[model samples]
Target: MKILIIANSKIVFGRELKEELFQKDKNIDISLLDFASLTLFDNTNQENQTYSKEFLKYKNIPKISMFFRMLYIKKVIQEYNFDIVNIHVSRWFYLLILPTLIKQKLIITFYGSDFYRTSNLIKDIQKVIYKKADAITFTNPLTMKSFLNYYNNFKDKSYVCRFGLKTLDYIDKNRDKSKTEIKQSLGYNSKKIIITCGYNSTKAQQHTKIIESIKKLDDSLLKKIQFIFPMTYGDNLNRENIKNILKSSNLDYIVLEDFLYKDENAYIKLASDIMINILETDSFSGTMQEFLYANNVVITGSWLPYELFDKEGIKYYKIDDTKELKKTITKIVNNMKEYKRDLLVNQDIIYRLSSWKNCIESWVNVY
Candidate 1:
């Protein structure tokens, strides 16, 4: 079957899916259109099709070009006659809204912030888009519920699609060399590891508060846990402020200024024992899923509703206040062995809900 995937600037997710599909079935035929980075008339055989940043900005692009892009995508889909067209994120309403108005098999995944945080007008536009969809996938139940309540319909169109990785098995395969090799490679020498990501600092991610909480930890507990900040991307000034805080705290920590690819991130997860985040209570993180799948202790954001995780048989520690944060850290460090049952349960639930292999097989069916 032929398929076309439309992704905004976050085309990495689509590219990864395309690669995985090819790996699973080399004969599969698929096309990708990164509408956020389109060029007006260049159909040359480049490695990938990309649009410019200006073209993607809803307020910046000329109206005529917008119409042209719509025609370009409509023509591409018609010419290819794809069996399924998947749009990765919903914020690109102008580009995707019209696609749903016509007759076609369409699937849109309401990934992360785009589902709950976009402007109301866009959400209203997507109300019609969601109705027209053959299927809609959400990462977590809370965001899914909020979205469905806003429209109060299309219940059947919604599906919970969590991101899972073959990580545990990957770690098991390289078990012999990994345990020590990775730790030594990264120069981690602490009794335990605590990791937080601030690739980009926004109020939602709460990079500052996370660091300040670490500063609040007592010297004894702080010394035992080596903190690692994957400061992959963010405003330079904000990152510098975080760096200064980390410096003054005198804690065992590593602020990774550069980025690590997916596999590298997995490698770090394998060596670490705790994963932390402070995003919006309802935010569903792809990285959190990876750590959960690895059976490591995952500390989740607090503003979330737990019924969904409970329904899925998932388990995690939730923290909002520094008091809860410090207490959870102490408990985990004191007896990391106690979390085995919870970890195993989480591991089972994640694999059951999010195996990419299963998702691909399901996609082959024209639902």
Candidate 2:
């Protein structure tokens, strides 16, 4: 079957989901359609290289751009003759207003931001899209609930399908490097490494607080910990913010240079001693799942959508308590082996839950 995916961009979870689907079924032809290029201004020359202004401009653009995009989308849909058309971002729902001159099974996938932070006009557009679609896919149950609350008639078409990751069967083959060597390569030494994946945005309001907490640590404890922030998109604002924090506090750390996406990310997860998801709120964070599968100690904020821990693993910190975060770090350093053992047990459960095979199987059945 031919499936066309229309999204804001060909990056982040969109790319990951595309890769997972194609790997599972070679017979399914998958194509990505992105509207990010439609924006007139490019911020590639800015000091921080952030596209915040560009994003704002795109949102506030004259109706001409939106109409042009709808016409372009309709043209592509007609020419491709796809068996199924799935729209990934809610903003693209404007295309649904065009009459169904060519009837194809339609679906909409609701990611967190599309449901929580979008404007009322977008939500109304989504309701219309939901009415027109054959099915609706949600990344988590919380998103499904949000959609239902917004449009009561969508119950029959909505389905919850969790995101999945590609598995690594031979991850141990590259484990010969000593922790000291790995630390040296990253320009650090024997410190407890805490890694956070993805961009730094104001929407992630809790990040500044996390940095403040790190700064509050005593010199003895601070010298034993290193913070690593990796940026995936949004110019280099995330990198710059992290750099400024490190400089102001005189802390030693590493920020990775940008590289194309690859499977090596799993290895980086495995190398870290701890992973943090400090989002103000999240339906799900793929980075958190990846770290759990890698058997790393995880510290997350209290607003996590679900309880990621069972009887023996994972740690939760209150957003207001820097002291509690410091205490957790101390506990992990003093009892590393116990934490590692708990994580090893949890790894098996995480592996079964996040396998790409299972996710694709669910998707195929949904249709």
Candidate 3:
């Protein structure tokens, strides 16, 4: 079956779906969109193992680009014998009407932030799109429930899929570096490491508060720990603000200005000792899942959903007290082996729940 995936494969799940689906069924011809679908699409300008063809790009004005893109998109749909047009993020869900015009089955996948942070206009458009879509996919039940609350008519067509990463994908067989070696390569001499996703906006993640939390730690404790932040996507002011905080303190930290490829990101995610994923609200975080799989101690926001994590018996921290949080860190460090043993069990549970292997058949049926 020929399916045109109107989503960028740069997203971990998007890349996983494209690669895994093709691997499982060679006859299924899968193609991903080359340009923006409103999310970051480029994988460090690296050549995609799958097919990619460039289309309209912004040349200073967005309206002009959209006009040309509409013409090209419609022309492509007419020429290619696509049986299914799968839209990944709801940012462009309004464009689902285009595939319907050509009688192609339209499947819209709602990523959490797109559906969760909707404007009035998008909500109105979603009501219309939901009625027309042949199928819809969500990463978690929370996002799906949110969509249903707005427009529940398409209940039968909706499906829930989770995201996960394989350990082998991050581990370089050729390089085969140990955890210690990976840390050394990154110029991290200290054995202690804490990772925080600073690429998120201030709302999703408390960037300033997180930084201050680290600052609040004792200087002796701070000296022993290395703070690693992936801050490529934040604004300059936020970046400078973080830099100033890092500078004023004697703490050793690394702020990655450039975005890392998935493999590199996975490596860092694997190597970190602890991760802070304190967020205001979220459906599910692929990064948090990665950290859990890696068996790293993770600090998350108490406000976010944790029913699944609680059921899985995953060991996570959502404590707000800095002193108490530090004490917990000390406790974990003292009995690291037992905590790791528990994490192994949690990892197996999460793997069973999040693996793409379990969802492949359903994905095929969506088409």
For candidate 1, lDDT tens digit of each residue in 275-334? 776666445565666667766687766675556666787878877774477777778777
lDDT of 3: 0.64
TM-score between model 2 and native: 0.79
The per-model lDDT (C-alpha) reads 0.65, 0.61, 0.64
TM-scores for the candidates: 0.77, 0.79, 0.82
What are the candidates' C-alpha RMSDs?
4.6, 6.0, 4.3
lDDT comparison, 1 vs 2, better candidate: 1
Clashes of 3: 0
Show where candidate 1 strays beyond 4 Å.
8-13, 23-27, 34-46, 49-83, 95-104, 140-142, 176-178, 190-192, 197-202, 233-241, 244-248, 320-323, 340-342
Error of 3 at 209 (Å): 1.8
Count of backbone collisions within predicted model 2:
1
The Cα error of candidate 3 at residue 232, in Å, is: 4.7
lDDT of 1: 0.65
Give model 3's TM-score versus the native structure: 0.82
